[model samples]
Target: MKRNKRKSDEMFNLDDIKVYMQMSAKDKLYWLERVAKFLHKITPSKNKKIWERLKERGF
Candidate 1:
């Protein structure tokens, strides 16, 4: 059975891509950090090197 996806999962359509492309540098940085943090959280404990890299980048 497929799980229901969140709105974030559906945010990569053309309109959203346009909006992302039009975002200011600061806005882009903000979103980038958010994505990095999210990835860091879900990363496996076995990947300590990956986690450290994210931390070094201030994620």
Candidate 2:
């Protein structure tokens, strides 16, 4: 038997967000860069504006 799951728009959990908010500045920057790099990789080159901007700024 299969179970059904209800989908909602709550993509982020408040508790998780609170923990992330408590992370130190260096940890926050590390996570931010990781997410940005992941986004750049997954997003198509044509839509990779952030990567292009970063390149222009000498990343």
Candidate 3:
């Protein structure tokens, strides 16, 4: 079944794309790949340092 899109899900809207535009090419590509594989609509930015911290926290 499909789930409802929440405010949290809405957080991944176009503004997130704006934040992504500020990143370097490699960083943006890395995140683009990650988000492409993400199952949930709530995907994080394509920033490696942030991903590293998330991994460190066991995300």
What's the alpha carbon RMSD for model 1? 8.2
Each prediction's Cα lDDT score?
0.77, 0.76, 0.68
What are the per-residue Cα lDDT tens digits for candidate 1 across 1-59? 12344477675466666678889999989989998999889888879787689999999
Model 2 local distance difference test score = 0.76
Better of 1 and 2 by lDDT: 1
Q: In terms of TM-score, which candidate is stronger, 1 or 2?
A: 2
What TM-score does candidate 2 reach? 0.62
Best by TM-score: 2
**Residue 40 Cα positional deviation in candidate 2, in Å, after optimal superposition:** 0.7
Which digits, one per residue and each the tens of the lDDT, describe model 3 over residues 8-49? 657555655667778899988888788777733465456766
How high a TM-score does candidate 3 get?
0.36
What is the model-wide C-alpha lDDT for candidate 1?
0.77
Predicted candidate 2 versus true structure: per-residue lDDT over 1-59, tens digit per residue: 12334348766666667778889999989989998899877899776776689899999
Q: Rank the candidates by TM-score, best first.
A: 2, 1, 3
